[model samples]
Target: MILPIVAYGNPILRKVGHDIDENYPNLDKLIEDMWETMYASNGVGLAAPQVGRDIRLFVMDSAQIFSNMDEKDKEEENYPDAPGIKQVFINAHIIEEHGDDWAYNEGCLSIPKIREDIYRAEEVTLEYLDQNFKKHTRTFNGVTARIILHEYDHIDGKLFIDYLSPLKRKLLKRKLDDISKGNIKVDYKMSFSK
Candidate 1:
């Protein structure tokens, strides 16, 4: 099943997600659906909040980013974590963030047609559980880290647009409003607040 992504201005996106346990209803099914929804929406990551579920869960496949890159570009951009990872995260927490911040043009499925250069740390150490409730603590770098951080924010009630400057956000107010009111076109399914 391809879940409908919650659009910007949805109150669920602004609420901090709660942690879930193994016994959570239909955990496997939900995770599977998330993967299907993410692929259908052509997104690298999707958080539970994005699908209108306030739970500390997200699915990411940074590997897709590298696989889509041209051979020449891949050679030039020798990211250590290139060819990244495809995994599910549950009850995730960032233990630490390392390295200087780098700017990347980031976009969200919920806030379609809006991309912005967001600055984030180059590396991150995270502690999270897998689909089976098995715990793992891992460190990620480069694009992989960025992807994790982006989805992590969603679980914490934060959005990439929140990192923008006040003036920049003001300039995009109209466009943002349009998204909230379903005045935009997106290939995948989305649920608007209004």
Candidate 2:
């Protein structure tokens, strides 16, 4: 099912998600629904908070991003070889972040239609579990790391907009307010706090 993504200003988005174990109700079904919702919404990543669930879970299919990029664009963007990475992350924690921070244009499903250049570390080492509750500690870099970092923030009760400077955030106040009140036009279904 395609769940209605929670919009900005929703209190759930501000809450740090709790870790869930394998026995969590309908874990497989929820992950399936999340994938459907994310692909339907044309999002590279989706966190549980975005769908109104305060759980440490997220899905990413950055392969879609690579499919849309041509060779020149890929070369220019210095995008690494992202070969159709489709994975689920549960109870994730970033163990460490390496390399210098780089600016990347980031966006979120909760904060629809708002994209900003956010700075993040070039690489991240994460410890997380897969759908089956199998644990793995992995390191990611380049565009993949950027996407993971963005979604990781969601589970931590942080938004990309929060990284903006005071002046930049102030300038986007009206637009953010509009999003909270369902004043923006998004192709996907969204639930607002109003």
Candidate 3:
């Protein structure tokens, strides 16, 4: 099942997600649905908040980014290794972020047709639980880390647009309002503000 992604002005997107344990109802099903919804919408990452669930959970598949990059592009971007990561993160926390900030054009399923250049640390160390409730600490970099950071923001009640400058945000205000009102067409299912 592909759940309807919550639109930009939805209050749920601003709510901090709560941590959930293994016993959470329909855990596997929810993750599966998120994956389906994300892929259907051409997204590399999807957080619980995007699907109207205020839980600290997200899924990411950075393989597409890895596969799309040519050898020359990887070398030029200093992306020597592509982790090709595909995993679930539950109750995730960023332990540290280091290295120079790099700018990446970021977008969200919840805020379709909006992409902005966001600068983020090149690497991030995170602590999270996997699908089976197994705990792990991992470090990620390059495109993989970028995707994680984007989704991680969702659980923290932050959006990529929040990182933009006041002027930039103001410029996008009308488009954002249109999204909230369902004035734009999107290929995937979306729940808009009434």
Scored by TM-score, the top model is 1
lDDT tens per residue, model 2, 1-194: 99999999999999999999999998899899999999999999999999989999999987888898888887776565466588899999999999999998998999988899999998999999998889999999888888999999999999999999999999999999999998999999999997
> What's the C-alpha lDDT at position 56 in model 1?
100
CA lDDT of every candidate:
0.96, 0.92, 0.93
- Count: clashes, candidate 3: 0
Question: How do the residues 33-146 of candidate 3 rate in per-residue lDDT, one tens digit apiece?
Answer: 999999999899999999989999999999978787788877776673374789999999999998999899998989999999999998899999999999999999888899
Model 3, global lDDT: 0.93
| Comparison by TM-score, 1 against 2, better one | 1
Query: Alpha-carbon error at 11 in model 3, in Å?
Result: 0.4
Model 3 scores worst on lDDT over the 10 consecutive residues at 74-83
Off by over 4 Å in 1: none
Models, CA RMSD each: 0.6, 1.1, 1.1
Sorted on lDDT, best first, the list reads 1, 3, 2
TM-score winner between 1 and 3, please give it.
1
C-alpha displacement of 167 in model 1, angstroms?
Answer: 0.6
Give the clash count for each candidate: 0, 0, 0
lDDT value, residue 161 of candidate 2? 99
TM-scores of the models, in the given order? 0.99, 0.97, 0.96
